[model samples]
Target: MNWNQFGYICRVKSSKTLSTEQKLQLCSESHLQIYKDNGSHSELAHNIAWQIAEDEETSQKQTACYKNIPDLINEFKFEHKGWLIYLTAVFIIYCFTSQLYQSFVVPQFVEMYSSFSPSLSATFDYYLTYWYVPIMLLALLLIIIVMAIIKLKNASSLTTTTPFSGMYNILLPRRLRNEYDALIAIIEFPYAYKKGFKATTAETIHFEKCESLGLELNDEFTVLLKQKLMSFNAMAKSYINKLVILYGIVIVVSVYLFVKMAYQPIFMMGEVL
Candidate 1:
């Protein structure tokens, strides 16, 4: 059947602690063999034991935690959809601005220069005729490259998500803040949404599982996990803040560059060359 139905079956079947009636309530009929409702406790327990054993085996195999590369790529692509539109608009604006400058403004100014002096008229004509297109295209290409680098680096680099990487995921845009929130939702999807509860439950499950094995946790374990979550949140905020500042800097620098380039003089030859 559908993925939703499959997921329900998996979740119910995976829970050894669940009862037969509980399984019936939660799962559909087709998956009953995987999670038979009226089975003996010993049989149910055996299935659960086997399931746990299998889960542990798969967990060990799968738990060699590499980068969540696929999820990240998908998330990045989804997030950049709006950014793609924005980039398109920016490109259009740049093209329109460049065209308007060349067509209406530059020629008029050239004519005005020619009226002022025959010597300068040839220089202004050369300014428009030779260099304008290449320079504008180069600038636009550089901007696109720089923006691409920033986005790709942000998506791939290790930060708070890394184990013992010591890096933080701080400084982000509000949209990135939303992204982190979305990531947090994914992290907590197995449980209901409650911030403190999610944290406590995660900690409790971890501790209880280990404690059930009669293993003594180092005194620092709780402290460490708590610190990690706190650091993750802080770093996320910092990342957003940094992004905002970076965007501000980009805008400011871009405006300054545009104005500087627009007003700067263009000349072909020196005194005698």
Candidate 2:
């Protein structure tokens, strides 16, 4: 992945072994060398970094740092997929069902308003009668929105400092705002058109699985992994933060529409009087 290359590049950046200017020049020269032409040094550096981040020599180690985390990754995947599907289903059901209620009830209420000056008491009657279906539906939708926000929150921790041990654990980017944006983060490639639902991941396999398939983990595996976690976390945090804002907007808009849909005629009656 392109992010993998970034991890390698960051370590070198941290090491201070090569001055910043030197690394920049090297990537620039290397870019020309590889493409047999000229291109962005930053892009070449990114590619070089990922090439250095692999587990090519991982089998030589007794216990790889990422060895025990395979189950964790799988469990995370299942949970993520489940919540994404559930959220989508909730929105779809609300769309169809809300349309039904709007079609069946609002026109009659509007017609009633035009025929006579309906009493506030009569309007309250409509609330009691018409509000039940959509109130219940809005509540259900609200719950799903809240749950999705929680899922995004749980999946967002990419870096942390264990103050006691001073150990840093690295994590890959998961649970992005959309699959295409997530893929861009993983591959470091651009897209002309990005499309997807609001929750998704790039296909990242655990290191143990890679080892089993005959790949090797390097000596700096944990550090490199941690670096990627830090790198991906920066992007994931920004994206998911926007998602939370989006969820909040949806909740507000849905509730506003529900209230207006359920009671616009009553308000119109008051205006008529």
1-273, model 1: which lDDT tens digit per residue? 222233335455445577756655765566544534332222222222222223432322111111122222223331334544554566567556667867887676666556643335554444456535444554555464346435434432222222121122332244444444433333332222222434344544664465458554333243433343344445544553454455445445545654444444333323334
Top candidate, metric TM-score: 1
The Cα local distance difference test for each model comes to 0.41, 0.41
lDDT of 1: 0.41
Which pairs in model 2 have colliding backbones? 5-49, 5-50, 55-216, 57-216, 57-217, 58-216, 58-217
Superposed by TM-score, candidate 1 places the C-alpha of residue 268 at a distance from the truth, in angstroms, of 17
**Alpha carbon deviation, residue 175, candidate 2 (Å):** 15
How high is the lDDT of residue 210 in model 1? Answer: 57
What's the TM for model 2? 0.34
Per residue, candidate 2 scores C-alpha lDDT tens digits across 1-273 of 122233333433344356656555654544435443222123433443433322223211322333322222222221244545555666667667667756776566656655764333344354445545554555554554455444433333211111112111112233333332332333321111022212233223333345447654433344444444444445544644455456546656665765675577667658978
RMSD of 1: 12.8
